[model samples]
Target: MTVQDKLKQVAESLGVPFVFEDWTLANVEIDRTPLPAVVYVLPASGELDFKNGNIRDNQNGMLAFLDKVELNGNGQDNDSVVDRMKSLAMRFIVKLNETGYFELLGGVMKYQVAYNKLNAVTSGIVFDVTLKEVTGICERNL
Candidate 1:
């Protein structure tokens, strides 16, 4: 499976919406009514460097953004959105740690507050992820 596919799988396993390939946000309909979503974006194209004979290292930089709309106009705190974002990000990290197939170099979860198209307050988290692909070595006997 591809790296994108694996990441999406991890997100789905945690019961969170996952988007990777084409139109990462197109799956949802964002009309006047706001919705919560977890979107994965590939900010830079992945780099494939030769590691050894017939082996290559694929490095991909990704960002996972958690979007939550504040429907209530009571000046609600962003605690809920922050919690959800942290939970999902933690799960992703755990999954990656368990699997030797990927490496989590380092990342930071940045809290953001912005206005949506409907002028609604949106609070979310953006996780900057640096991922490295795992290489497999095969032994052949003649």
Candidate 2:
């Protein structure tokens, strides 16, 4: 499939919204959500990926939030906590791979996983991707 098609597939798989003109060009808008959410894009011919997304630390409100994952610690459930988070991350990455964009010519030229948030206001919702992932399969360039 063409590059655009590939990208579209990725968006659809992840339940993310996207618009494409001429059935080739694509426009994807990711909402800055809470709970470790993310929207990453990897261009072709690039070594890194761009994570123009958001990751709201749900556990930030409380301390020892991840203590649960620490099996050694009494009453600590770090395992479950970390597991759930890892699961979410896994799902996100899996969906992106299924997207047609990764299958584009040279496919996923670059990629990265970043962190950021959305400035939601009465006027409208604007997502500000603060942290951009410069490593991973999504790199600078081919």
lDDT tens readout by residue for model 1, 1-142:
5676777777667666665532334333323223454555654656664455434346445544455555763435566666666676667778766766676544554434333422335555555565666753322310
- Tens-digit lDDT string for candidate 2 (44-66): 22222335442211110100001
Assess every candidate by TM-score.
Answer: 0.66, 0.27
Whose TM-score is greatest here? 1
The CA root-mean-square deviation of candidate 2, after full C-alpha superposition on the true structure, stands at 15.4
Query: Which prediction has the highest lDDT against the true structure?
Result: 1
Error of 1 at 96 (Å): 2.0
Clashes of each: 0, 38
